[model samples]
Target chain A: MPLYLIGLGLTPDSISLKAINIIKNCSKVFLDAYTSILVSYEEMTKLMTEVLNRNDLIQADRTLVERDAGQILNPAKDSDVAFLVVGDALCATTHSDLYLRAVQEGIQVKVLHNASIINAVAGTGLEIYKFGRTISVPFFEEKWKPVSFITKTIENFQMGMHSLLLMDIKTKELDWKLYMRGIERYQNPRYMSCAVCCQQFVDVLNTDNDADLSVETKQDFEEIRIHAAKAGFSVDSKCVACMRVGTDDQKFIYCSIGEMAKLTEHMGAPLHSLVVLGNIVSDMEQEMLNLWKL
Target chain B: MPLYLIGLGLTPDSISLKAINIIKNCSKVFLDAYTSILVSYEEMTKLMTEVLNRNDLIQADRTLVERDAGQILNPAKDSDVAFLVVGDALCATTHSDLYLRAVQEGIQVKVLHNASIINAVAGTGLEIYKFGRTISVPFFEEKWKPVSFITKTIENFQMGMHSLLLMDIKTKELDWKLYMRGIERYQNPRYMSCAVCCQQFVDVLNTDNDADLSVETKQDFEEIRIHAAKAGFSVDSKCVACMRVGTDDQKFIYCSIGEMAKLTEHMGAPLHSLVVLGNIVSDMEQEMLNLWKL
Candidate 1:
């Protein structure tokens, strides 16, 4: 059986022509959806139906992917079956597990390369190479101390390398899941923002002085930039931010964390996580500097 | 002007019906290729050409993006325009840059959020919150020292965090304006492998012993499981070495990296990089541990 592993790059149009052909021809497709949400299920199902002319949108949530992954690979045991994930194939370990399953069954597997956030974030000119240990800041509980993220951030800071802080994902609606609306998303835990992010960060840092929270002027970091984004594909709408990054639109005007918090009101729709550009904002990243400056 | 920022996610079918509508209805379409290669030019051009019934593809490369991004944005300035990326709009910073640019021009920018590598890698059951900093492993250099990757790697190991190492893509076809395969790819200086990567990492560590390169044994890592995947949304022709990363395939079983190197001749194609499973490789993964003793 032939199994196809894929990586969904950044944008809907970011895929390679070769990948499209494979998916279009595949007999069965199993998507490991929990790793990351490349796009909405409604969009993916429709696209598949239109291209492959197939309506069978197989669903593999965290549970099914963990327990019944072997069953998903059965089609590949004889036919050209496909398993998909966001970013690259091996980018997620779950895909690796699926691969192991296929390998044990003596199935042939081929991986197609595509851009993932691992490199995509480099566009900010943050010197990705200089980034130190990456970590995630999970939503805190009053009882549990989720300080690992703080610990890592400090480690990177002490080494003078930037840190890549990944936020959290709370949901994964299936192919049959209904389309979510703006109001519905707002009702859900929205994507974190720079202003809210910084406040939460400083609050955490203040509690953990090991972070050397005093080193960076709270004023500079507190000057949060809000880049509010929508949840669906917007053809003509540009991504709106507190200030432009990576262009001559560099404006270093600082806004207070409290002032930045105003973004919650001003930001119209669903927001993604905030990229709190730390110690290494470059001169070329003009708008980032401007939005986070005095 | 409404600008649709479509995120292809990782799978070719991950796109939505709404996104297709935007692409088909838009006056002009540009695929932002740099930040992500969500879809290949040939495949998308063929399908989009047929599905959307567009006159032709905008086909913007790095140069156009850098020099004449304005042209791509022209449609968005006054009309409905669409630019697509691999995973999600904010997944890559370049798209954000585009947004900032349009905003400066008083153009309306909209972002369609899809799955991105940043959030997707968590599907592997490797706690999404446990990752450290992300680093890129550049294609080898004879004179230029790229030991930074080694250092970053060690730092992640120290924190017990897995590194999402992205290989450098110095594609000569795009840079030199030539597309030659075979030896041309060699000259192109492309993807990195586990072997070369190990060698470079070792070399980098040898420079500073105090930094401590020795963590878990290579056998332990390879034995645990290695995941090698390329990000691809449009192409299902991808492979992910999920199971038995550290063990042998069929008769060709070798215990250590040293042994694996010896068998490199018969080991089929050169391997892509490996995702050494740190957190998820449980004792259960030890079933493939037999290769470790050989």
Candidate 2:
């Protein structure tokens, strides 16, 4: 008996035959429902049940996977179990933790890798080799606005390396207000758009407040802006906005960060990403960017 | 009719249902024979033909794909055609060029992405977000040794970012001896081993030869050595050697560069990669690396 950790890639039919076969033979199938979503649970359940000709797929939310992981690994002791994740099995740290847990328990662990946004970012025609650290931009709420990703983008640009910004996605989130009133309700899914992300970048760059700083010390806004200018990144810096990459209707928009912040009216869909260009864009890359210029 | 660019991932069964559906309806299917190899031509042909129940897969060598790409694009003008790549479709510049060509010729193009080494490196347990620019280690011939990858590795270390080294792979390579004698014969495939790559790193770092450099000015050996040392990368720097990733028999070995260089006797199969550890390995990353440490 083994625990199969399989990646479903990023599309409805991106599931591989190898993964499908493993799911078919597994005594239990658990889809990780918290980290990311490929499709609606109803749609995925319908597809899997139709293909495997079995209806045992379980939706494992954060509570089930994080708080009670025993439910996922316990069954594998006696029979094969499948833990399905969106994108590659090891992309998220949670899955890696689960893998370690399975290994610690002396259970056979098999990982089936698949496409993830980490690799799919190559579709932007920017050389994958030129990319530096990947950063994520979270949605800015009234009270909690963070700008660590902006700092990361500047650091990457200073090194003449491209920065890949993965926009935030909130799925099956708790309605805090309702929860506080002793009523439990889930909020609608929210995905950060490039427009909002760029606006945050501009706002953060213009601000003097250090309330969001998690580090021990903070610097003046003037010093930070000077460093950013030296790194060749400003609100006017060129960046690429990607929407639903790898799918049929996938779209890309190339413009300055400032222009993208103003183009909020055109921002569309979930699962968006942005790439802040570095100081060393080659001629070929520049030509490719021209194809998607706004 | 759209020209489908499908990624087969890194395994025989890694092909997705969406890619299969697209290939099944294509008037012609081409397996890119130059960039990389997933399995042998015989093995992949058997799998695709058996699964799709068709035998129209054309092996598109460099000559056909680079020189005569019109053949790949023209058919899509009238009917759907598929150009299959081993990893993700846009990971290589050649495929992106083909895509631009198709768009320029008014042919509709669709890209079906899949797992690539770029993302599969996540399996090593290093945070993908911490990776810097990717570098490649070329097979060092007696007269043509290059060390640019070493410079890139040191630069990545300077930024406290991990460096992903894609080992050199030679498939269907021209035998220069025969080609010079007016013969068109290709030598057997060659994949650079992590052991060889580590040894090259040591050799390049120890020597002061400027002959391998293509830069405008030559650098002194001592100057390069000092920079590398300051960047926290030496022959004894910690690194990870990955062999045949995304496969069932995939193996990882974490050790010093010098140690890996000496452990050449155990270097296994094709499709190898190396990751030079940076200065910023987190506690979790260190624990993960310990799992595979030698």
Q: Top model by TM-score, which number?
A: 2
Q: Candidate 2 on A126-210: residue-level lDDT in tens?
A: 9888898888888877556565787788988877888899988877789999999999999998888999888887766665456
| Local accuracy of candidate 2 as per-residue lDDT tens digits, B131-230 | 8889988888755666678888888787788999998877778999999999999999888899989988877676556566644323434566778877
Candidate 2 Cα errors over 4 Å, as ranges: A141-144, A172-186, A206-220, B172-185, B206-220
Q: Candidate 2 at A51: error in angstroms?
A: 1.2
Candidate with the greatest DockQ versus the true structure = 2
Best by lDDT: 2
Give each prediction's root-mean-square deviation over alpha carbons: 12.2, 3.3
Error of 2 at B285 (Å): 2.2
The TM-score of the first chain in every model comes to 0.68, 0.90
Sorted into a CAPRI-style docking class, model 1 comes out as incorrect
